[model samples]
Target: MHVPDGFINAPVSAVAGVVAAGAVAVSLRGARKELGGASRSAASGGERTAPLAGLVAAFIFAVQMLNFPVGAGTSGHLLGGALAAILVGPYTGVLCISVVLLMQGILFADGGLTALGVNITVMGVVTTVVAYVLFRGLTGILPRTRRSATVSAFIAALVSVPAAACAFTLIYAVGGTTDIPIGKVLTAMVGVHVLIGIGEAVITALTVGAVIAVRPDLVHGARSLAVPLKLRIDGELVDAPVAAPAPVAARSTRTVWSVGLVTAFVLAGFVSFYASASPDGLEKVAADKGIDAKAEEHAAADSPLADYGVRDVTDTRLSGGLAGVIGVGATVAVGSGVFWVVRRRRQDEPADARVTETV
Candidate 1:
């Protein structure tokens, strides 16, 4: 949940800011390796794959708008960090979550502008790293079976949401303005989020499992486990297709792009109307424990896009729907453009001198 300004003290928020910045810095470097890795599947497209990455980000943003109920009056939205990291690469996933949080804070005024750093740290960095690590560990330790991947996805996502909640609690313990008991805060935050985590696990597992079924090659987390393209010589392993990887045809890219964009539009524009209107886990806890007493109103609350509605749309549903659609479009366009540029820039780099010389 987008922790608003008054929820966490300035010191805690600042620390989160630093943590978030550091994580982004690390991801920038890691992204190079993740994106540059070799692939065996015919779908292991390179630079042209950037548009798909963008679609993942946009889809995450759109689905996040549909907040599912946890229990009681509290609800939880799709953090999407784990889902993205599994679907796309971890670095790109971090970038994707950051973009969504930025839009939410600045455009929708949903999350506090001042607390943007904290949200990014707790929701983006913590979730992505935790999920990715768990996914990898499980994939390695368990049998290399399809069921293992789905099971791993479930556990990784289940753990990540509460881990984020615990992180927030720790931050609050350090910089909490009020004298609330740390134990109570921790217990409450973790307890509520555990339920939320179930929802997270189901959603992440379903979404990731779906992609892995269709295009496991497209899934960054699942890339290393890709089925090797071996020669069928008497049912024995042979030299895999290791040289000059096949290029991604333009027609395939167009198909993926179109389908993804359409899915994002439908989810955000129409499905969001039915999202739970109840308070989220954090909001419910804040009210129950008096943590919200010092909460400050967001400065951008007056913006036209604030609260997910256009400025002058007469119908509430129409306004919110349009805003959601526009948000999806904008997020997709920006994310895709940024990723395309990054992929292209990397493409332009000379192939590794050592590898080239060897070849």
Candidate 2:
């Protein structure tokens, strides 16, 4: 959930800012390894991974626009932590959600400027960390099949939403600006979020399964599950003969990237118009429990894209559609840029090490 300004006291918000900053810094370092590929020979994997990471970010942003109804005047959207962490790696997943949150806060005014740290800490860091841990643990114990990976993705996603809700409750218990009782807020937050988690699980499972079916190689979480051929020699199983490396085909990510970008465009530009207008899980809980009593106005509320609408666009459909498109474009561009920079840094580190050795 995007915490607005004034929901948490200034001191607590500042502390959250520091925590968010530190988390982001750590993720940046970890992403180098994740995106750079596990082996030096596959340094080119960065070439394949970087663009896909950007597309994932854009897709998350687009899907978030389509708020599906949960129940009782509450709706929920894809948090993208599970989806991203499963598709990419956890480090990159954190950055993906952080990018989406930053874009929403600064461009759409969906989240507050002062509360950016809180939103990032809860939605990006907490969800990504929890989902990745559970996904890894489940996949470890389950069969190493694509189906198992997909199932793990589902369960991880289901748990991550409630985990984030609980995290927020704890944060509010310590820093909430309102007089609401902690118990009431905790109960309401966790109860409704459980429903939201189901929606998250379904969406995550479907998306992860689709990707696994198409290009399992691209799914970071499924990589370890990929099985190699084996042979029975002398009544004992042994590793199969290693095939010589074939001539490298001119691999192109254009087709997959195009398809993903088009899908995001359709979801945000067309389908979002039909999404439920009800308050999301966090919003509903806050409204009901008086947790939003001290919520302040977003700094960018007067911006053109504030509230997901274009300024001076009288047609609600057109205004929202344009804003959504813009959001997708902005997210893709920024995400790609950031990922590319990280990838480049990864590429450079080896060279710097070599130079040091020479010296």
Q: Model 1: residues >4 Å from true position, as ranges? A: 37-45, 227-248, 350-359
User: Which candidate number would show the highest TM-score if scored against the true structure?
Assistant: 2
> Model 2, poorest ten-residue lDDT window?
37-46
Put down candidate 1 lDDT per residue, 1-359, tens digits, no spaces.
Answer: 78898887887788788888888777765554454533312333444346677888889889889899987889988888898888777887898888888888888888887788889988998899899899999999887766788889899999999999998888788877677898998899999999999999998998888877866666677767745667868887896767765555678658767887898999999999999999998888888888888899998999898889999898988998999998998888788776766665555556674245326
Clashing pairs in 1: none
Q: Per-residue lDDT tens digits of candidate 2, residues 1-359?
A: 77888899998889999999999999998788777732442522455677799999999999999999988999999998999988888999999999999999999999889888999899999999999999999999998899999999999999999999998998888899998989898899889888989999999999999988987777888877866788999999998876764433335467778899999999999899999999998999989988888889999998889999999999999999999999999999999999989877776787656345336
Task: Report how far residue 15 has shifted in candidate 1, in Å.
Answer: 2.8
Per-candidate local distance difference test:
0.81, 0.88
TM-scores for every predicted model: 0.89, 0.95
- What TM-score should be assigned to candidate 1? 0.89
